[model samples]
Target: MEEGKICRTNPESSDQVKAVHMLLVSYPLQGHITPFIKLAYLIAGRGIMATLVITEFAHARMIASEPDLGNERNKVRYITVPDGLSEDERNDDVKLSQSISEVMPGHLREVIEKVNMEGNQVTCVIADPMFGWAFEIAETMKLKLAIFWTSAPGVLALILSIPKLIEDGIIDTKGSSKLDGKIQLSPDLPPLTSADFLWNYSGNQTPAEIMFQYFFGIHQNLKRSGWLLCNWFHELNPLVGNLVPNMFPVGPLLASGKPAANLWPEDLTCLSWLNKQPAGSVIYVAFGSITVLSQHQMDELALGLELVGRPFLWVKRSDLIKGGSSKYPDGYEERVANRGKIVQWAPQEQVLAHPSIACFLTHCGWNSTMDGLSMGVPFLCWPYFADQFYNRSCICNGYKVGLALSPDEYGIVTRHEIRRKLDSLVADDGIKVNALKLKDMAHRSISEGGFSARYLDNFIQQMKE
Candidate 1:
């Protein structure tokens, strides 16, 4: 497990062992990076060489968090490419997406060519579908391409149904929703409104237009992709399999023997703090990586946590507040200092898995949703945007394992509402029962003879062919 060494198969092994090498390209974001890394470890465990490619900025953060990230023992090699954005610009979704589309394709091409020249020929290219250009490169190089859909399969189904929506006059070619009421995709699934559309931007039409075009391009590319892999299980959303028949669900891709692929160094101190709290007594609050709360909203959240009067662990990222200053209300820290622990970032999976965690107050991002569900933690959902709304619907309505925090007239989830939600969430035994049920299902999905296990095996077998 030496540093700067690429772990390979043993030379003493039989030559019949096909050197199946996979190149995984992740969209440079925390949520995407974690599952992609887990996928790399999973593939490497199966006697395949997994080369994970990410942006240079993300790589630097990853290395900063874990100095020896891709050691030989992990059996995964790491590579970095320029994302063509400055550190500050990374926060802007539109700018970041534009840069990735414009700048990353050539760099990805160079990486592929260089890897093939090094004798460890990349037999397959597995990439996040956000980077549609990867498909073009793989096609040009005559390499097999498998797209990794990081979000919920339901989200994918929704995106893929865009054409139908347009044809039915529910939406336009530009991806805008024409309806004022909620639309039911199926009788069994939760209903969604126009706001729940993947490309829906509330106020800014420009960003919505940009995102629509971006996803539309990805949608077109998905048809030609050799394989479609999702980071979820059949039991979580069984209807997704019927909706997107070609997709293979092989996840809940949680961390295993290796450290979590975190962009920020996790404060392990929180684990020790959780150890002291009573079982199922603490609320875990985190809004994932990209959610930026307004200053007033941040203050309200702080007051809300205090009002809940429960032991709480909150992950307050450095860039959590919109304008950067995450200042709290007057004497807010002093009032809740004894019961609260705040960190820049936490080991989320471990936190969610902890016995002290009663419920989660989350942004309902797909990765966080999977983590919460797999850990069997009931949720107090506060979704931000895009697929998050859909994930919230799954949590609140479909699965019935969580409750959504309704915002006040001003579009802010006030302290009173937060307190009420937390109170209700912890009191509801039904929610807890459902959460545990999902947890068992999630674990079973990855175990032997499970749907995810069989699909993963099939995917690896396909790689050999």
Candidate 2:
């Protein structure tokens, strides 16, 4: 494996091999980028020429860290482009999403044209639907395009229901979801309320305004898209994907060979930490990057973890505290010295897969949900925002594989409450049983003739056609 320029697999080619080339463009965020890179690796390994287009920051970081992208035969070409952002603005979630949506289209078009100039054809654009501008560019170029929605199928169903919601007067022209209580999206599904709306933004914040507009734009642009590739399976949300036409449920897109884009340096030291613990004993606590807990919330969490009095590995971001100060009380670490390992980040997939990890206190992000599901870990769902609430609903209400934490009046999970949930998660065998069954179904989906395998095959074949 060598690094300098990305290359096609072989110099010699046939017309058939040249016929199928794909360009995958995801939003410049960890959640969107990781799975698409995994999808790129999968597509390329299946003997198609696939290029993963990412922001310059992500491209540089991943290239320096991962060797799999440079390996032979199953190689994916990397197209690095300006994110129209800076080092500082990268952490500003609102601006980053807006910027990626604005800048990526021109950069992506350049890659498409460059590939054409090289005498190879780029037949399709598999884009993360967050950036709807890709829909316009691909339409103008007349390239076959698929909306690679990275969230759950149920989330997609919610997005698609916007027009109907407006028409039914359940909501207004603005994206404000107004309802007194839960309403059924379908007969088979559980009820949803105003709370489960993906971008249930309060009034007049610019970022929230921008995000609402982004979702509306996605709704409009996706109308022209003939193919919708969901990064989930039929087992998860059979109704959501099937209700919508040309929907291909093709995932649980697990990392197999090439490690998907990891921005944070994973502390592999955690593996050794797990080895010392008894099987199914350590609590794996990680909220995905971008979730910031308030200072009080952070303080309460620390007290709660100590109260659990169990071995735990907690991934704590430096900016987790609101006032930018340590939330832990004096002598806290010494008191729980051998009981916990708190780092800035850990290799989450590996941590979730570890035998000693008994329960996962997760943010309920799509990737985290999938990782927990695939690994058969019982979940303690504590969602902060966005699709997470819905994902939590799916976990706790839909699948019955998790327990939801009840927050106090001030929206904080009190120490005693955390302890109780942890106790329930540890004591409950039914949830664990369901989690294991879901894990087996997830594994079987990627096996021969399984749901993911068949649909993924269909999707790639559509790319060729």
Per-residue lDDT for 136-204 in model 2, tens only?
Answer: 788899899898888876677777888888898887777776678877776546678886776674322
State each model's CA lDDT, in order.
0.84, 0.80
Worst 10 residues of 2 by lDDT: 1-10
Give one digit per residue, the lDDT tens place, for model 1 in 1-465. Answer: 222223333232233233677899998888899999988887777777788888878887888897667566776778778778887899787789889889889888888777677677788999998777898898889888999999876678777887888999998988878988988775556887888887775744466777788778778877878688899998877776766656788888877648667899989999999999999999999998878899999999999999989999999999898776778898888889899999999989889989999999999999899999899999999988778888888899899999999989999999999999899999999999999999999999999999898898899898888
| Residue 285 Cα positional deviation in candidate 2, in Å, after optimal superposition | 0.3
TM value for model 2: 0.93
Off by over 4 Å in 1: 1-18, 203-207
Question: Pick by TM-score: which candidate is best?
Answer: 1
